[model samples]
Target: MTTKRIIPCLDMTEGKVVKGIQFVSFRDAGDPVQLAKQYSDNEADELVFLDITATVKNRPILLNVVAKTAKEVNIPFSVGGGIRSVSDMQLILRAGADKVSVNTGAVTNPALITECANAFGSQCVVLSLDAKKVAPNRWNAFINGGTLDSGLSAVDWAKEAVRRGAGEILLTSIDMDGTKKGFNLELTRTVSRAVSVPVIASGGAGSMQDFADVFQTGEADAALAASLFHFGDLSIPELKRYLSEQNISIRRDV
Candidate 1:
């Protein structure tokens, strides 16, 4: 069986890691390089650094931060936000990002997915979707840092992106972001069932049980959390040990 991954997310802005609720009211988390190295040492399966405001601000990703993080961390990480073309992905990859995540750019021009995948191979392309519940059992994908709705069904979009060559899906629930309630199981399961690619579930992770639920009930291939780890609420080693106790396969060598 493929071991489920536990990834720590670094939502960044102005070169500092930040976290917010429902994509607003941001608060400083810590230094990206410091957190990246800490998570790496803690045995996080992987890391994700997203420039939260890059798309809405129409700015490029913070390559200096990415490079600094690359130099400090041993595990692979993905970078996203403000990536509009193949060149953007190239620059991010060249800066030491193991994968490039595209959201707003893909929503605006889905061909960008095919282009990035072709340029760097599908494994290097991750489709990051910010989804909000529009109705019971239905969620809409949002773009522009979750300010605008893309009007695409989250599940359908995931399937389409995978068909276009996305190797993985980073599904974040905008409604549940920073709520610390739990993951959006319905949204995650739907997307995970629709796509063959690994689906990384984000938003609303409050406890270790939440992680187990996301993997077993939500059918997610991975679970990602930001504030839970950033604020000393939980450690990767503790979470991994808990997951192992639950018979959820995870890398536990930290």
Candidate 2:
């Protein structure tokens, strides 16, 4: 059985790691490089560094910050935000990102996904979807740090992203983010069922049971969280042990 992955996400803005509720009310977490090293040493399966402000500011991802963070950890890391073109993807991968995640950029120019996949292989291309519930039965896409609405349905956009050559989907529920309630299982299951590629569920991870629920109920390939890992409320090793005890397949440090 393939072990389900546990990933820690670092939301970076102006070079500092931060976290917030529903993608707002930001609070400083710590230095990106330092926090990343700690997570890596503590047995985090992977790390995601997001330049949260770059896209909102209409700027390129800060490579200097990525370089600094990458230097501190040995685990595979992914970088996203303000990544607009193939050249931008190249720069990030060269900076030590094993994968490059694109959200707003892919929405604006979907061909960018195909371009990066062709140049760097689909495995290196990740499509990060920021989605929010707009009505009882509808969820719309948001971009530029959840400040602008794309007016696209989550299901439709996810299918389009996969068709355009995304190897994986990093689906985050803007409604559930930082709520610590649990993952948006319906949304995750919807996307995972819609796409052939692996779907990673992010946002709203409050406890160990939430992780297990996401994998079992959401059918997510991986579960990613920020605050739960950031504040030491849940350590990766302990979380994995808990998952194993529950008989949920998970990668354990040998």
Candidate 3:
């Protein structure tokens, strides 16, 4: 069985990691570079650094911060936000990122996904979808840091992105974001089944069972959380151990 990945996300702004409920009411968590090292040292399978406000600000990704954080961790690092073109992705990759995730930029220009995959291989292009449930078993993919709806069905977009050469899908439930209730299992499972690529489930992680549930029931390839790991509510090591006990195949070498 493939070992399920446990990833800690760094939602960043002004060069600092921050967290909020449902993507608002933000508060500082810690320095991105410092936290990157800590999570990498503590056995996180991967680190995702998202410049949450970069698109809204109409700026490029913070390459300086990405470089600093990348240097601190040996694990695979994925950076997202404000990446509008292949050139931007090259800049980020040159800065030490293993992969580049595109959200708003990809929505506006679906061809960008193909361009990125062609330039850097599909494995290096991740489609980051911020999905909000609009009805039962229905979701709309949002962009601009979950501030704008792209009028695209989240599941449909996932399939289209993968067909266009996105190697992975980073699916986050805006409704469940920071709620700590649990992951949006239905939404996750739907997308996971729709896509042929690995799907990383994000949002609503509050406990260890949440991780197990997402993997076992939701069928997510990976589980990602911010404040749960950022606020020390749970440790990656502890969660991995718990998942192992639950018979979830996880990377114990971390």
Candidate 4:
């Protein structure tokens, strides 16, 4: 079995790392490059830098920070937000991002996903989804940094995204964002089963048990958390140690 991954998400706004609950009332976290280097030097399996407001602000991703952070980490790093075209993906990849995640832009024009995957190869295209539970076991995809509901079925979109050549899914639970309760296991499992590509579960990670639950019960390939890691509530190595004790094979050497 492939070892489950533990990733640290760096939600950035205005070139500064920030974290917010349910995607609002944001607070400063730290510098993106510093956090990237910190997670890289630690045991984090991967790092994700999401320009959370880039799309809403109509600005490009912070490439300068991405370049600096990319130099700090040896592990895979993904950059997202304000990525609307194939050229944007190319620029980010050239700026040192191993993968480019598209959310609002892809929802506005899904062909962008195909174009990016075709040009950069499927491995470099990541579909970042912000979903909220509109009904029981049913989620609606959100856009514009989780402010607008796209009226797209989250599960259906995941399948279609993979069919369109998206290599991975970054599934974030809008209801669970920074909730610290636990992941939306039903949503994660539904999307994971709907797509062959790996699903990275985002939001609602509180404790070590939350991570274990998402991986086992949710059958998630990876669990992503920002506030927990950013606030020093838990460290990647400590989380991996806990996962190891639970018999969930994870990369501890990183």
Candidate 5:
């Protein structure tokens, strides 16, 4: 089996890293650059910086912050929010994001995904779907940071995104986000199994067993959480060690 990845997420707003529950009730976490460096120093597998309010604010990503944060970490970094066009992706890539994630933009004009993948290669395009359960065993994609429902099936969109050249899928469960109850295993497994590309499961990570359950049962390629890691609930090394003890393959070396 491939090593299960543990990714630390930084949800950005107004140039600072923030964490919110269910995509609301925002709280300050820390400076994005400092947090990025700390995670890198601790051997985090990867880091994701999301401009959570970018879409709602209708502004471009904070390139200055992205550039500064990229310099602090050597690991792969992905940036999202306010990314609407190929030029936007170019700027972000030039600024140092290893990958660019899009949701509303890609959904509005899926051609953006093809254009980005064509311009920067599929490995650079990550389609982030903010999904929420609407009916029995059914979930719809949300855009603009869980504010608007796209009415698209999470599973169907994931498949189409992959077909359109998205190399990865960042699946965030809006209902489960920041709940720490556990990952939406049903939602995660459905999307993961539907897409050929790796799916990073986000939201509802409460404990190490939660991580294990997502990896083993949810079939997620990578599991991402914020508050648990940002609040000192668990360190990356500590989590990795626990996962290793559970016989889950994981990267030990930074």
Candidate 6:
């Protein structure tokens, strides 16, 4: 069986890691590099660094921050936000990102996914989709830090993104983000089944059982969380040990 992955996300804004409730009421977490190093030491399977405001601000990703954080950890890391073109992706990868995640940029120019994948290989490109339940049966894609609704259904967009060459999908539920209630498993399963590439479920992870739930349902290839890991609510080593004991495949810390 494929071992489940536990990834900690550093939502970066103004050079610091921050967390918010349902994407608002932001509070400082800590230095991204310091937290990243800690996760690395604790055996996190992977790391994600998102420049949360770059896209809304119409600025490029903070490559210096990426470089510094990448230098602190040996594990593979993916960086996202304000990535608009193949050149933008090139700059990010050169700055030490193992993969570049595109959101608003890809929404505005779907072809950018193909361009980046063609130039850098699909394995190096990720499509990060911020989705919110707009109606009982519909989830609309949001962009620019979840401030603007793209009016696109999440399922349709995931399929299109994969068809356009995104190697993986990072689907986050805006409503569930930071709530820690649990992931929107329905959304994760829908998107995962809609696309062939690996799907990393994000938002609303509150406990180790939540992680197990996501994988057990086959709704996500990996579970990514922030507050639970950032606030000492959960430790990577302890979480992995618990998962292993539950017969869930995970990479245990050496």
lDDT of 3 by residue, 21-43 (tens): 23222233366777788789888
Candidate 5 error regions (>4 Å): 20-29, 55-61
Clashes of 2: 0
Error of 1 at 21 (Å): 14
Candidate 6 or 4, higher TM-score: 4
Q: What is the lDDT of candidate 4?
A: 0.88
Clashes of 6: 0
The runs of at least 3 residues in candidate 1 whose Cα sits more than 4 Å from the true structure, single-residue gaps closed, are 20-29, 55-61
Q: What shift in Å separates residue 156 of candidate 1 from its native position after superposition? A: 1.1
C-alpha RMSD values across all candidates: 3.8, 3.9, 3.7, 3.7, 3.7, 3.8
Model 5's TM-score against the true structure: 0.93
**Each model's lDDT:** 0.88, 0.87, 0.88, 0.88, 0.88, 0.86
Full-model lDDT, candidate 2: 0.87
Reference-based lDDT, residue 112, model 4: 97
CA shift of 250, model 3, Å: 0.9
lDDT of 6 by residue, 215-243 (tens): 87846899999888777778788889888
Residue 71 displacement in candidate 3 (angstroms): 2.2
For candidate 4, the per-residue lDDT at 85 reads 89
If both were scored by lDDT, which would come out higher, candidate 2 or candidate 4? 4
| Candidate 5, poorest ten consecutive residues by summed lDDT | 20-29
Task: Give the per-residue lDDT of model 4 (tens digit) for 1-254.
Answer: 78999999988888888774232223323677877877888888889988877753534448888888788789999999888888888878998999999998899999999999889899989999999999988899999989999999999998899999999999999999878999989899889888999999999999999999999999899999988987778888999999999999998782
Clashes of each: 0, 0, 0, 0, 0, 0
How high is each candidate's TM-score? 0.92, 0.91, 0.93, 0.93, 0.93, 0.91
Q: Report model 2's TM-score to 2 decimal places.
A: 0.91
* Residue clash pairs of candidate 3: none
